[model samples]
Every structure is written in structure tokens, then in C-alpha cells.
Target: MDVLYSLLDVHIQQLNPIIQDKTFTNTLNFILTTSTDDIVSITTPILDRFCINILPTIDHNIKSLILESKSMERILLAADYPSLTKLKLFNFKDNIVSYYFTDESSFRRIFREQITDLILIYDKNNDITVQREYRNGIHEYIMKFFHNLKYLSINGPSSHLILDDSSPTTCFSSILTKLCVYVYCFQDCLTLLDGRLKQLTTFIVEIDHSEPSSIAHNMNNLPNLTTFSIEYRCNTTEFDIQVLPLLRRMSNLEELTLIIYNENRTRLVDGTYIHNQILLHLQRLYKFNFYIRTCTDLNNVTYSLSSDNIQQTFTNIGYRHVKCILYNITRMVICHAFSLPFISNHLEYLGNTFPSIVFTRVTKLLVFDILPFEHEFFIRLARFFPFLKDLSVMNLHPQLCKSDSVNYDHNQQYPVIEYPYLDSLHLEDSYIDYVEQFINETKIRLPRLKILEVDYRKLNTITKQFTRDVTRLNCAKVHRLIMEKQVVFPKTFYVYFPLLESASSYSYYFKK
Candidate 1:
């Protein structure tokens, strides 16, 4: 019975952790069966054993179930969970709503009667925006379907559940106390605060686009809301107009996190501006974490502003560990500022000019520059960001001192540039040399690399149409591969990438 404590909150993947490690592996059956007429071709003997031999023995004690779309029904039928109250669904889409949430389903009664917390991971949104999954259908239904839904989280950037004035009141949830989801438009964030979900106390939203939103004139302060966080990926120039008004409404918030990305010279989200405009207003706020990257074009600026100008702004502010760096390339100044130890697990647009600091916490890093990423830079990166798990190299320019060329002439040489823990690498927007730097076994080693995103052109050029043995070690380990160009599944591709299960074509976008 002591083992039942761990089983109180059951994640289906726990039974088959090795097999269902990747995103493609977990939802592979669901993607295949739903997209085509094929049944689930994959077998799960462990899951069968859990259901047949284990679940019935401890069903009454189970309080939570986190499941995926394909085997959720089988797992539910195997047990009558008397104490189940929390349900987190992965790979949840519009097509499966009827399969699980409707009256036709056997577990529908238990879902509506027992579940109070629901987390729907749409599973496709790796970036900020995704379109393949359900946008509004599943969200609108769950608000009414769950009789006691207190905490509702819809993961993914496109899970924007927006309702206009014509929307029915049934879509509104008075029982919901915490809501974390994405919004399509800036107005949708405002729409959430428009007397809907009257009991929502903690709100975390990611606004994909900052379009022109009609400002709510008499917006009431969110007194009940103690937690409010936003990640506005507005590449457009509307951060000031669209974001500031929304923050003013959360005057009573206790915890606040703002990760805003945009380009602006004058209207910067620097420490001084944040202190004067934001922190001063939120009197109840005790905790705040922020990562604000605002690019400034010095071409049109009348006055000069260096990294010193921005870093000095944090001197008076209470934020002691805040670091600011301005990467000046040509006429464009990339202002990257954040409160350390790293706000999120990711950092972007970093270059050779970045300050020497140990970012032990940042697991995902994006290195963007027109200048060639030299071998020394990689050595420096491996030393500073020791635990980088996912790395994105976005340089169209090739490396000057290529990995093979490094220490060819000089006696002083850098140690092997090894990312021992890196699981994913993205060279989709980079050159063939970078592909060589990481994949070529002689150059560097990525022991845990499983996912590779590259351009077909560079990949083909480097690996010589997937015939090179130099990259076979990494290509063999990569389970999922993403190429900018559509790839023909030639025998060579398969020969090179033996462990490949998923390969898709995608275009990687960087800021203008």
C-alpha cells in the first residue's frame, strides 16, 4: 500500500518511460490512427500488464490520471478510480473531444462529476503558434462539461479560447480559479478580464500577436488575481500600446513574470522603465521574473545608447543580478537584458560579443549572428553554459576557423567542444559548417542528441547526399529530423538515419 502513494498521481508514461520519451513516440499512434485509417500498430505489453495485473488492485486510491489520446480509454476502462479528481490530457485535440468528453463515452460521468483540475497539452505547439490542433472547440466545451473545474490549463500557443460578445454565458466558468492558456489576439487577454471567469485568481497568458486591440475604458482592477504572467512575442512595434494597459489592470497581483520580445529604440522595457512604469503600480507584488529583449536600430537614433547606458538603469532598482548586454552588429543594436539566473530555460540572439557569465540554469540557447561562430566561441559556450540541452545556431555565414581547421596552424588548441547533455540541435537557419561542427564525430560529440533540425541543402552538402560516415553516429541517434526543404525518403536517408521515426519539412523564421 505504501507504493500506492506514488500511484496517487499516475502518468501513463511511467509504465513505459524508455519507449515514450520523445513527443513523436508518445503521440505516434494517435497521429497515425487519426490521420489515416490505420489502427494502433504499436504494441504496449507493459501498459497491458499495468491494466490487467496492477490497476484494479489500487484504483480506489488513485487521485490523478495524466494520459494521452490513444490509450486513455483502455486505461480508464481497466480501473474504476473512486478518488480520481485531476485529469491531464496530452495530444488532446478537437477530434478526440467527442471520444472522451461526450455522453457517448463511458468515463464521461466520472470526468464531469470528479475532475476539478484539467491540463490539456495540445502537443503540437513547439513554437509560439501552432494551427494543426484545436483552437477554440475543445476549450469552449470543457468550461461547461467539467462541473467542478477549478484549475484549467490549455498548453500550446494556439490554444487561444476567445469568445466575443455574441458568445453564450455557458462558455464562462465561475468555478475556474486558475487559467493558463494562450491568446490569438491582444484583445482576447482583455476579454478574459471582462467579467468572465469571475473567480479566476491566477492567470498566465502568452499573447502571440499584438494587434490593435480596443482598450477597455473602465477596466476594473483584478483584486482577486494574485498571480499574472505574460510572454508577449510581438515582433511588431505594439509592446507599449498593447502590453502596458494590460499590466495596469493587475494592480493587485502578488507574483508577476514578463517575458516580452520586440524591437524598439525609445520605448524600451529596461530596468528603469520597468521600475517606474510597472513595479511601482503593482504594490502587492513581491515576486517578479523578467527577460526583455528589445532591439534598437542605431541608424535612425539621434542619441547614442550603449550597454553601459542600459546596465546603469538597474543600479537603483532592487534587482541585483540583472545583466544587460548590447550586441552591436553593423547599425543594429540587439539589447538582451534579463534578471538572472535566466528567467526561462531559453535565451536568444546571443553572439561572440556576449559578456563572460556562467548561465548554469539556461538549458536552451539561440546563437544568432552574421559573423562566423569560431571554434573559440564554441569552447567558451561549452564552459559558460555548461548544461545547455537544446542549442540553436542561426548563422547563415560559415565558420572561419572550422572545427577541423581549428589548431591546424596554432599550437594552442581548445579542448573538444562537447555538449554532453544536449538532446536537441537546430541548424535549420545556419550553414553546412555548423552541421559539420556538431554532427561530425571527430569535431564534437553530442552523446544524448536525439532531435536534429537542419536545412536539406546544407545537410545534403555536408553529408554528401546522406552517404558520409562522418555524421553517421549522430544521424543514427536522431529519432526526429526536421529539414527546411521537403526530403525524399531515399534509401540513403534511411541508411544515414537508421533511428529516424519522424521527418517533417519546416521553414525557420528569424527576426528581420
Candidate 2:
């Protein structure tokens, strides 16, 4: 509960009198929430006070708890909540699940008999992990554990959650009515849609890769499912085999959401393609939200297709707040279109081609551009997305026009890019010039910047071996410094980032 703690700390002096009020202190549900902020831990004192003074007082009133694995044990053991039914567990690992969820764990009764809604959110794991075998056994254990579970969701950082559990035991969830999950492949996704959950209504999934299996594909469709959504993170070319065919079977869907982006020169997922291939087949559908981006080679375009042509298609469908941009640059016809306001909290791939609207809701953004992201583009971004907390830039080129951006001598050339709410800045896949553009106090001002991911050599060189005076202000507040490789720096490095609590290097993190 980083936001809670921060609010309490910020207003503690004024709120001490109010905090002492019996009415205020008696409401302990605020203490039961997991932190939405990047800083993912609660202080020991906060935990101790919560367990000792607060939880027991309002134990019966508690109905739900959202907790990270680190503090989950202490909080769960704090009080007996007679009314508790829902749980959203984050940062879960296999070992942690085995210790607490397998066999005779203390939470066995609560999980098996009490909880009806469960959300297990794990950290990104490429390897098959979680409660013995994530690929084979985790879903089985989940279905087996929660007896009265009506809604169950399992999420991961990436689409590669990798669940290979096609066991007949998991094939049926009699009590489950809703499921939201991520799978490694389409076969695993088809396993979920294989007409096992007779009561299942809402099914949301994000799959990494798609490989059609005739046996799984030919299995019965989800006729009971009224709500359905599918998202693709990978550049998919299998709409005919993977996506559309699956949709043709789910004819009972009432609400549908699709977020798809494809780079392959397959059919461009425009209005006509979506209508004929997808929506036309789903006769029972009423509500729809979509964000479809297609990047096709210019050489492949046969007919006249312009931004106006694409815009009219969306307009015909009565999508009022839709934003569509067509960029004919770098020998690729890149079309970005999405219905607003943007629903996803973490937008996947954004670039220089952006709409001039405030995406106040989006917390995480990935900026990828073959062309350089100059100072103006950054300024436009910071100005529009005022509440952006996480930004990952993956541009490989340096700023093309620096004269309009950088102040060489004394004249302030451009307005400094500021991210007042940003906590995480990832420049690990970007050029060193971008490193300099951000770290240099003159070009950008990151007041709330805490997490920074950069190349070790680039960081060192740009910071002038950690003694650069110009970059000190921007580097001063970085709490977690992520690098390509582990390297112990001089005393100046620590001095440069005085608030840096930790430094780490992950070769795997850079592979993204």
C-alpha cells in the first residue's frame, strides 16, 4: 500500500488528530490493499502496527484482501475474517505457493472453502514455474483448491505465462464462471476454450504465440461464454488459423475486446477485415472495444489506402473517440488505431506517430521508433501523458536534430521534458544520446524518477565516470539503478545518485 503509506506520511502531521479518531482508526480495509506504486514493500513498522492494532479491530468487516507475497503471510495470519472471500495475490512464486498453498498450509481452509474469487499475479517467468509445475500443474492445483471459486484469474508480466496443464482434471471447472489467464501458446489457450468449464461465461486471454492444433481447434466452442477478449503481443500472421476460427465458434459472446498488432504482410486488420472476419460472425455481440495496429510494407500496398480511408471505416462503426494515424515512413505503412479513452493501463508499442491527447489513465508506456525520438517528441509526450509512471524507450538512433533541442552555451533552446509522476525510466535498449538526453539536467527534468534502466558503459561514459556535474540533479534521486552487467563504481557514483538504494545488472532483462 505505497499510496496509502505515502498519503499518511504526507498528511501525518495534520492527520495525527484525525488518525486518533475512533471512526478513522476502526476502518482497517485501507491497510489491506497491495501497493499499486513501483515501490513494492511496506515498512516493518507499518506491518507490525497493522497486524497488532488495526486488523483485529475490524476483522469481521473485511471481505477482500489484495496482497503481495512478501507481506501476505503476516497479514493473512493477523486476524480471522469471517466475511473474507476475495483475494488478489501478487509477486507469487512456486516456492511460496508450495509453502503456503500446497498440502497442509495454514491458508488451506480459507482458500479451499471460503474464497470465491481469486487472482494470482506472478512475476515474469520465462521458465515453467509456480507451485511445482506452472506449465502442467498450477491451474490444476488452483481449480482443485478453491471449491466455491466463481471467478479466477492468473496473470504474469509478459504474455509468455506458459501453462501446459491440459490434464482432464483441469478440463472441468464446475464452480468457475469466469476466467482470465495468460498462456505460452495457442494450444494452451484452446485448452481453456475446449468446452470444459460448463459454467464459464467470461474468458479473457493474452497468448504469446499461436500454433493451431486441429484436435484442440475442432473441440466444442464456448457457447456459455458471454464475454470474451483476446490480445496478441507477438507479431502474429495466423488470423485465419488462430484468431478468426476461434471467434467463429464463440457465437454467444455479448461483450468483446480485441487488442491486436501485426507486422507481417498478412491481411491488414482494418475495419473491413475486422467486420467480415470477426464481428460479422459474432451475431450476439453488443459491446466491443478494440485497439488494432497494422504495420505493412509499402511495396505490398496494391489499392489506394490513406488515413482518411481508415478513419471513415471507424466512423462508420460509430467509434467517436477513435484515433487513427497512418505513417508512410521507413518503407512501411504503419497504421495505429484505437478507440478511446484507452482502456489498457500499459500501452504496448508507441512511437513518434501519436495522437495529441492526454492519456491520463495509462500508467506504463513502451516507446519504440525506428526514427530518433527527438526532444520535441518527448516534450509532447510529457505534456500529454501527465500521469505516466513507467516509460521504456527502445529507439536505437540518436536525436537527429539536436540544435533545436540542446542548449550548447547559455540560451535555453527548448522547454525541458518533465515527468513529475514518473517513477520508472527504462533506456536500456536506447542509444547513449538518449541516456545523455535524459540524465542531462538541462534537457529533461525527472523529479519523481526512482528506477532507471540503462547500459552500464553508456551510463558511465555519459556521467563521465560518475563525476559529471551536469547530470547530477537528474541522477540524484534514482533509487534503483539497473544495468547491462554488474560493475562496482567509485565513490562518485554513489554520490551522484545519493538516493540509490540498490544497483543490479540483469543480462536477461536486456534481452527484451
Candidate 3:
């Protein structure tokens, strides 16, 4: 007979090490299935020594024995375990319609003392919440036993669980400090009394679109909180920013992540500016992340420069100076208002009008974008931000012409115009023909060239011949040829592709 000692979940059978050694007992979580008899037969004495988890007598009965015994069959049980800490039950397909607390009292009597962190996952089949009278009796039994429990997780809809005024009295008083719930409505938050949440440190709420105010109000209530996340994507309505003053009250807050959908109105009111100013008042907040659908929401904001200038209004401020500036220029629409100028143009203005802006503060600038094929504005863009260490360019658009110039090469005979101290260059695009001349020219000039990523666009016989000629030159330190729609390598056109780990369109090849 094999004596097995292990911590096991039957779902991940491949990764689990089979119990071959019996020298030491192990902490175990044995998930009971139809093959449990075989498991018990293989490892009995080893399991008795270790911390093992199995369905209690009543839970085991529901798993086996399909016949519905409705004549009020009672079972007797007894257990004594000291090392148990975490317990979870997912009795979705158990068909627990007829099992009452009085009948399953033997199983409850054993579990009520040992279990600490309990997670119960309820689904359609064994949904106790649907049976009101039976669920209430079961909850009463559970609350009485697991009084010392700290972490509690209840999954499923709120409509399933019946909560009256006395529900909190039975369960939510002395023990629980961390609570995570998936249900909606302010009713869940309002129901949790202040006494129960006084010692609470972390609370995560996954609320639906219908209850934004409830999420906001709960954020206000948790004064002892350190981390908070609210996901309200489906909700069409905007959360009232009036809650900012209340949120400012959370003095101990360290991290906050707010993900909100786009609002219908573009023009933000002056009151919104009032709330934006409140962020500076937060003395403890070191890290902040705001992800809104529109940049138009950032319009209008005031800040304090010093005690001397209390009347001064400032729109944006970065606490610590950032060395690199990343420009993401996709899906941005501006119809000629008092909008900011193009980044390269803005940099030029800051350098000329405010000469102190360049060569002193920022060290590097990385621009990765697909400029419109029709416009040749990149020549003008290359002039600004003269002190860049790493320059990365990605052309996302499909079509491009060879004559379109984004000049980086400066001739020795020309006027003294300092080139950017560009140490690394990363280029990726489908239009390699358009950038062929630029690549050939810059490869010889850029002495500090180290890394490159090139994705070739789909082409016919003529274009493939052109690509082979470029490949044979073998100019780049890391050159990769990506033939989209197929993997057709050119004959004897060997080029070193140190970085060609995999291609993007892999599955498309198999389909063809």
C-alpha cells in the first residue's frame, strides 16, 4: 500500500508531484471527487498525520448517492484538527435543495470551531439562497461556529442572499476585517455597520454600472484604507465629482486607481476645477493614476505656486521632473481652440522663447508613431528636443513613399547644427520600401547603432527582389525580415537576425 502525504487540488494533476516518500507528513487540501475512495485506499495513515481537507460527512453524502432521501435522514459526526487555516467550498452541482440545517447539524458542529478563512462559491445548482427558509437556518448555523473568522468572500448576486436588520448581528460584529463582494447597489455598503468595519484595512468592491454613488460613498467611509480600485465600465452615467471633498478626508490613503468611461459633455465646469485643486491638499498621496477616456476633462485647474501668490492659477503640474516624455497621438481630436501646439513645435517654442527649457533639465525623448502618409511634417519635427539619448521611431501606417524625408543625417560641410546623441535606434513598420533609403543612409552615419526591429510588408515578385537586395547588404547589427501572409525566405540572401524570436502573424500561416 502507498502512503501518500500532499497538498492537492485534483484539477492540476499534471504539475502535482506524486507522493513517493513517506518520511515526513505534509499539509494537505484534498478535494473529494468520485475517485476519492481510490485516494483514501492509497493514502490513509499518511493523511491522518497531515493537515487534510475533505468534504464533511453531509457534503460527502451530497457528492455520492443520487437517490433523494426526503424522510429527514440525520447523520452524526466528530472531528478535532488544530492546524487548519483556509477552507473553501464550491458546491454548485451538489443539488442541496432538501438538506436543512437541523439535518446537517452534525457536519456544521464539526466545522464551526476549526475554520477561519471561509470562501463559499454559489452557482445555479446548489444555490442555497434560492431556498429562503433553508438558507437562513444554514447561515445561522455557520455564523455561530465561525465567529473568529477574519477574511470572508461571498460570491454571487445580492438578490440571492436574504439580509434583514438582524443579519449583521449574527455574522459581521467582532471578527471580519477584510471583505470583498461582487454584488451591486448601495444597500450592501449601507448595511455594513460602522462597528463591523472599524478595524477594517482593505475593502475591494466590484460594483455594476447601476451603483456609482454607492462606490463613491463607500470610498468616503473607509478612512483607514490604503489601496482602492473601482471598476464601473458599464455604467453610462458619470460619478458626481462632489465626492472629492469627502475623498480628500482620507488622510492615510497611499494608492488609488480610478478607471472611468467617457462622459457625454466635453466642457468641464469651474466646480470640476475646484475638485482638481483638492489633490494638492493631499499631503500623503505619493502615487496617483487617472485613466479617463478624454483629455478634454483636464481643462481648467488652479495651483499654489507659493504663499506669496495665492491668486495664481495653474493647469498642470508634475511633482518630480521626468527625464523622458512619451507622446501617444492616436484618437486625439481638436477643432482649433486654445489647444496645445504639436509636441515638436511646442519644444521648439520652449527652447527659443524659454531658452532655459533645453540642455539643462530633460535628457531623453522617445517618439513612436505612424505619421500620416500624405504629410511630410517629420523634417520639421526632427529639429526640436536636441538632447535625446535614445530615439525610437515606429511607422504604423501601411503606405509610404521613399522621397518622404525625416532627416537625421547632417553633412560635415553644412552649418554647425548639433545632431542628437542618439545611442540606440528601434524601427518597426510594414512599409520598408518607403524607409529603405533612410535606413541605408543612416546605417553608415549612426556610429552608435546597437538594436533594430524591422517588419516587412506583404509584396509581389518585384518588391521581393528589392527587399532581397537590401537584405544582402547586411548593414544592420540586428536585421529581421518579416514576410507577412507567408514565410517566403529569399534565396541565399543571408542576413543576421539576432532578435527574430517570433513573428506576429503566426496563426495566419497555419490557416493558409
lDDT tens digits, residues 54-160, model 1?
Answer: 57765665677767667788888997887788877776666677767887789887888898988887655234343544445357788788898999998753466
**Runs in model 2 with CA error above 4 Å?**
1-61, 68-71, 123-137, 158-165, 211-218, 234-236, 368-372, 394-410, 423-433, 448-461, 478-512
Check candidate 3 and list the clashing pairs: none
* Candidate lDDT (C-alpha), each: 0.72, 0.73, 0.36
Rank candidates, TM-score, best first.
Answer: 2, 1, 3
Tens-place lDDT digits, model 3, residues 1-512:
12332334346655233432222122323333332111111134443432233323113222111111221122122223333455554442223323432335444433455456656544323333354443432333444556566666655432223333444354454566665555343334344523445655555544443443333223334567665444333222234443244346556767654433333325322213423654555667765544232222223212312211211222334322212221223432111111112112111111101112334222333333445332233333234445443444445554443332223233222222223344434344325533443344332233333333344442222134444333322234333233334456554223333334443332211000
Q: What 10-residue stretch in candidate 2 is worst by lDDT?
A: 26-35
| Leading candidate by lDDT | 2
- TM-score, prediction 3: 0.39
Lowest lDDT sum, 10 consecutive residues, model 1, at 23-32
lDDT score of model 2?
0.73
Stretch of 10 with least lDDT, candidate 3 = 345-354
